[model samples]
Target: MKPQRIFITGGASGLGYSLALICAKGGWRVCIADRDIERGEAVLGSLQKIQPQTIFMPCDVTQFDDLNAAATKLQEIWGGVDVVVNNAGVAQVGSISDTPLSDWQWIMDINLMGVVRGCKVFTPLFQQQGHGHFINVASMAGLLDVPNMSAYNASKAAVVSLSETLQNELKPHNIAVTVVCPSFFRTNLGQGMRSTITGMQSKLDKLMAGSKLNAADIARQIMRALDKKKSHVLPHRQGRIAWYAKRWLPRTWYQRLIHSQKK
Candidate 1:
């Protein structure tokens, strides 16, 4: 049997890197796509050692033509892709009023529309092949509607919504969609974060460093969910508990619970 072919955006570092490494080790033909050419090639070196056919693609998800061309190129090379991980995203923290309109558009373009473009470009390819899987990386902020990160939350929330829509819309077509909503873990996400808070970046770094589940742990959980064809995945226990609480708890009570974190 031929190895499964997988394409991952933002695959140079963080969860994307972990996912690519895992898939490559499992004998998949991996395409590591990111805008950072230096980092992408660095990761390419490692992946090539594991799976020589692994290729690095310089992809900026915000560009529709880039994504479309990537889909086209991969189709020609591999014949068909088994999975597309729309894992490229960024973090931003600020009150809605404090955040500039430009910042909102920036995050949404990369985080939300990036995933949309991936799906749009690949859905037809998947349909033609009769099988494909999409792994969309979201965040717990999207599910819980956390405070102080309006744009980031909204973008991820939109991804969750779109993933759900695709889950049902593509069910009969033999394509599977899984949205991963994970709380913070150790990652370089803070490095590119946009924030108005004076020390929020350092705080984010600290918060992520404190988490027990790192990117590799989350990546493994995602792979497991994909193998099982789960529609929704919350990789952390606390995230799952909070999601259930928000769903079952009363509105005022949940609001209090949400507020209690900072209080």
Candidate 2:
């Protein structure tokens, strides 16, 4: 049997890179797509050591043409992709009132529309193939709103909503969708986060540095969830707790609890 093919956006670094490594090690033919050709090639080299069938393609998730071109190339070479992880995203730290309109646009373009573009470009091919999986990386902030992360939260929430709807709509077509809501883990995601709040980026960096979970560990768990066909995955204990709380608790109570903890 031919090895299954997995395509990951933003696979040059962070969680996407970790997922690419895990999939390649599992004998999957991995295609990593990123706008950063240098970093993408570096990661491709590493993935090639684990699985020789790995390749890196230049893809900017915010551009439909870039995503479409990458998908077209994959179809030409591999017929169809077995899995597509729409994991490229940008973060911003600021309240809705404080965040600039440009910042909101930037985050939305890359985080929410990026996923939309990926799905739009790949769904047809996956439908033709009769089976495929989409893993959209959201965040715990999407489930439970946090202060100073309005833009990031909104973008991720849109992803969660999109994934849920897609899961229902694509079930009959044999395409599976999983929305991954992970808490802060050790990753380079924070490196590019723009913030209006003073010291907010440093605080986030410190918190991530102290996190018990790492990107590789989260990648392993995501692979397990994929095998199980889970519709939603919260890879951290805190995320799971927040998810249940938001679902079961009263809106006022949850708000109070969250706000009371604000420093």
Which candidate has the top score in lDDT? 1
lDDT of each: 0.92, 0.90
Q: Return the top candidate by TM-score.
A: 1
What's every prediction's RMSD, in angstroms? 1.2, 1.5
Model 1: lDDT of residue 73: 94
> Residue 156 of model 1: what lDDT?
95
Residue pair clashes in candidate 1 = none
Clashes of each: 0, 0
Native-referenced Cα lDDT, model 2: 0.90
How well is each residue in 204-246 modelled by candidate 1, as lDDT tens digits?
8777877889888988888888888999888889889889999
The local distance difference test score of model 1 is 0.92
**Where does candidate 1 stray beyond 4 Å?**
none
Models 1 onward score TM values of: 0.98, 0.96
Q: Model 2, range 84-179, lDDT digits (tens) per residue?
A: 999998889987798999999999999999999999999999999999999999988888888778889999999999999999999999999999
Residue pairs in candidate 2 whose N, alpha carbon or C atoms collide under 3 angstroms: none
Report the error of model 2 at residue 195, Å.
Answer: 0.7
